[model samples]
Structure formats: C-alpha cells, structure tokens
Target: MAIQTIIVGTGRHIPAVIVPNSAFMHHQFHGPDHQPIDKPNEEILEQFEAITGIHERRYAPDDLLTSDMAFLAAEDALASSGIDRESLDGLIVAHNFGNVRPNAHRSDLVPSLAARVKARLGIRNPGAVAFDLVFGCPGWLQGVIQTDCMIRAGAARRVLVMGADTLSRVSDPHDRDSLIYADGAGAVILEGREGEPGEGILAHAARSDTFEHSTMLLMGPSYRDSAFLEAFFLKMEGRKLYRYALHHVAGAVKDCLDKAGVDLRTVAKVLIHQANLKMDEAILEALCRLAGLEGAPPGLMPMTISWLGNSSVATIPTMLDLILKGDLEGHAIRPGDTVVFASVGAGMNINAVVYRFPRS
Candidate 1:
C-alpha cells in the first residue's frame, strides 16, 4: 500500500518589528564617527523594494529566540487547521541555529521546542519527539521528505514540519548579505492519508554537487579560528551560486516531473526558493527552456525576498503562507492544479517535489 502525505494545514509567523531596508542603511552604513552615509535608508529601501517587491520584514524581538518563532508558527498552523495538538504524532524542525549551548549536538533543540509546544498547548503525549536538521535553505525540503517517510512507515500519522532560523543573529552587520538575512518561521501539518492519483506528494528528487559546498558556509564559535566566523556569516559567491542553482534546480524540477509522469504543460505553478529576484528570473527561464514550456503563459512567481530576504529553510513555507493570504489571488493556481516546489540551498543541494492540489 502506497502511503500519502497530504498538507492538512499551513502557517507562518513573522516578528512584530517591521524592519525596512532603510533601517539597515541607518545602522549599518554609518561611519565610525556616527556620521550618516551617503545613501539613506529611504533610497536603499526604494531600490530593494522595487527589485524584490518586498516593502518590509518582521524581526524577532531582542529577547526572543528562533524556537519561539517556530512555536508561534506551529500555533497558527494548528489553530488554522483545527487540528488538536494532542493528536500530533511527531515534530520535525529544520533550523540552522538553536538555543542550545555551543558544541552541544544540534538535535537537542528539538526536545526543547517540543516541550515548549506541549506545555503551551497543554498536550502531553509520550509520542512527542523532536529532532533538528541543519541543511541551510534545503532544510525544510529535507524535513518534508523525512516526515513523509515516517508517516508512510506508520511511525507517525500527524507530523509538524517547521522551518525556523535567526540568521541575522549570526550575520555581519557590515555585509550586504548579512543585511538581507532576517528571522522568521513557517510550518505545515502533513497528515498520513491517501490522496487521489496525481495528488499530494507525487514525486521528489534531490541532487548535490559536493565540490561547490564551500559556495555557502557558516563557521560556528566552536571553531578554533574565530576569524572564520567573520567570513562564515552568510557569505556567498553570488554569481557562482546563481549559475549553479539555475542549472541544477531546473534539472531537478524537470526530473521530478518526469518521474511523476507529468508534463510541464500540466504544471499550474512553480513555487521556487525565494533566494533573490535575479536568480529566480534566471531559474524560471531555465526551467521553461528545459521543460520546453517556452511561449507558455506566465506562471505565479510570488517572492518574499524583498521583505523577508533569504530565510534559509523557512523561505518555501513562508512563501506558501503568503500565497494562502491572497498574494497571488489573480494567478492561475487552483484546486487540482499541479505545482512544483523547488529549492537550492547552501549545501549546494537541490531538491524538487511535485504535488497536485486537492479538488475542492
């Protein structure tokens, strides 16, 4: 019997602080003497907003940690889905940083978050187990695969898939890449159930070009050479990464669709990782060409990068939340639609999944 994982609910939580791009210019570009830089926050915000279509982004309060954001999103998802917390069988979080002590195993953050959720919701079940995956932007996709497998194996029936990160905390304020990173969380409830053929998670494909792993990296405090941390904070060979992601993600998307026996023409929309506006456009073009979808009508390309910037693993679900909020209301996506979820992240990892919306 083939097991199916259906998206029962989705939610996202952005922080209360709406940090406009101008805020970055004001704090980061100032001279050592506290003098204003030539470019004001308004000008920077205008440029970024125009290019990325993001006006502002929310940031976690100073005292709040990434796990808090994760719980926030989980609460929203459970409420919106009307799923009782007590019924949840497992929790899977994709996070790059945790509240745990340095050098401690990263998986420890899972139980900590699980405890908070259980306490807040007053749901105590021994089945509640938490685990963390640190795969940068591809973390959430990896979580989806793991959760799907677990549900299929009967290890879990209801799985909470969460992607949360506080990249800004580890970022270099002086770097543009750091300025673009923000903090937030997004989540979805994947329940074990069978969907009609060509629905739910039809197929998934992943690939990694290990030689390009260094293209994006984060060195932790445990490293003896603290200097590496200076370079590790969201550093990227932008051009190199853009080229690689376009080529690889495009291929992965097509491969997944092919394996699912679906044609590109049947794809209603492509929900890609909101890495950047330029990279997105390039990947869109490449996917069209590879799928022989040229001259096809334009598809939905909702982006959260302008405001949320690069949220690592949280980008996909956050964008999905934005979609649910009518961000692409005029777009052609509808029930029974075939969509592609694709991402390429820091590990030089590429993953793509094909799903069909349930018919209303």
Candidate 2:
C-alpha cells in the first residue's frame, strides 16, 4: 500500500520588522556632499515591489535566534492542525544554522525541541526525533519528501516539518548578497490521509551539480567567525546561479511530472523557491512554453521574492502561509488541484515534488 501523506496544517512566523529595499539603497551609496544619497528610495522600493510582488519583509530583533522562530512556527502549525503534540510521531527541523555555537547533534536537538514543546504545551507521550539537514534552500523540500516516505512506510503517523534560517546573523551587512538574505521559519503538519492514488505526494526528484559548489559557499569551519563572516558571507555568481537554477529546476520538474505519469498542464500551481523575481519569471515563462500553456498558470505565479529576498529554505512554507491567508489572489487553489513544489539551493541542488490537494 502506498503511503498517503496529507498536509493537515501549515503555518509560518516572520519577524515584526519590515525592511524595505530603501533601507538598503540608502545605506549603500552616499551623496558627493557627504550627506545621504539622493537616490529615490520610493522608486527603488516600487520597482522591487512591482517585480517580486513583495511589499516588505520581516526580521527578528537583534537578540532572537532561528530556533525561536522555528518553535513559534511549529506551535502554530500544530494548533492550526488541531492535533495535540501527544499525537505527533516525530519532528524534523530543517535548518542551515543553529542558535548555539558548535551546534548540538541532531539526536540532542530532537529531545531538546520535544521537551520544549512538551513543557510549553503539556503533552508528553509522543516520541520526539530531531535532526538538522543543512541543504540550504532545498532543505525544506527534502524534509517534506523524507516525512512523506516515513509516513508511507508506517515509521511515523504524524511529522512536523520545519524550515528555519537566520541568515542575517551570519551575513555581512556591507555585502549586497548579505543584505538580500533575511530570517524566517515555516512549518507543516504531515499526517496520514486515506485517499485515491495520485492524491498526495505523487512524485519527487532531486539533482545536484556539485561541480558548481564553489560558486556559492561558506568557507572555513562552516562556522561563523568575524573574519570568515566578513569575507565569505553569502557570495554568489549571480549570473551562473540564475542560469543553473533555471536549467536544473526545469529538468527536475519535468522529470517528477513524467515519473508521476502526469503532464505539465495538469499541474494547477507551481510553488517554486522564491529566490528572485526576475529568475522566477524566466522559469515560469520557460515552463509555460514547454507545457504549451496559453500563458502562465492563470494567476498561479510565483510568490513574493523582492521584499523577502532569498530566505534560503523558508521560502516555500512562507509562501504557503501567504497562499493560505488569501494573499495569492486570482490563482486560488482548490481540492484535487495538482501543485508542484520546486526549489534550487546552494550546492547547485534542485528538487521538485508533485502533490494533489485532497477534497476535504
């Protein structure tokens, strides 16, 4: 029997602070008179807002850590699912960085997070499993695929999938790349749902081009030191990355759809990694041409990328939260609709999964 995993609930937590592009434009360039630059902050903000459809982004205060955001997002996901913590079978946290230095092992993190939730929510029966997957932007998609497999194999009944990152702390404020990255967390509750075939995770595919690994990477102990942070903070060959993402992601999506015996046209929505507005637009255009769609999936376009920039792994679920909140106007998804979740992260990794919304 194929395992049927349904997304029972989804939630996201973004920091209260709204950082606009103007914040960056003004801070970067100064006027000849040694005063503030005369660049039009409004124009910059408006161009970004129009391109990525992102008004503003959220960020944690100076003191808060990534785990804090993860905890909040998890609590909300569980609550929204209406399932008590006691009923959960396991927890999987997908992150690139840890709050504590040297980072605790996965075995240690599971119990720690579980204990935190138990003490806070008053549930103690469910066993907790925590592990860190440092796959950069593709981490969350990997978590979802892993959870689906566990549920299908009867290894777990319910799983918590979390994608949280605080890139700001490790980022170099002076770097253009660092300025684009923000911190956030998003989570989903995956549970068994009996349904017809092809209704859940129909297919998933991933491919990595390790040869391009050096294009984007963090050097040294992979730990943040002052000097390391200053030199190695979020460096990227933007042109190469943009090209690689389009090629690999497109291939991955087609492969997944082919494996599932579904055509691209059948896919109702494409929830791609919100890396960049221009890149996403290009990918969508290519996909539409290949699938022979009259145009992009009617309003099912990419979510906000300009404001949020590249949130690493948190992009998917963060966009999912927006979709749930009715923010994705004109492209409202419905039951039985087939959606594709695709992402390309550092390490030149690309992943794509096909799923069908259950008729509730």
Winning model by lDDT: 1
- Candidate 1 lDDT over 242-280, as tens digits, reads 678766778788889899899888777788877777778
TM-score of each: 0.85, 0.84
What is candidate 1's CA lDDT for residue 211?
76
Number of clashing pairs per prediction, in order: 1, 0
Candidate 2: worst-modelled 10 consecutive residues by lDDT: 100-109
lDDT against the true structure, each candidate: 0.73, 0.72
Which sections of candidate 2 miss by over 4 Å?
A: 29-55, 100-123, 219-232
Least accurate 10 contiguous residues by lDDT in model 1: 219-228
lDDT of 2 by residue, 55-128 (tens): 55666776666677778888889878898777888777777755522222112344454345445555566475
lDDT assessment of candidate 1: 0.73
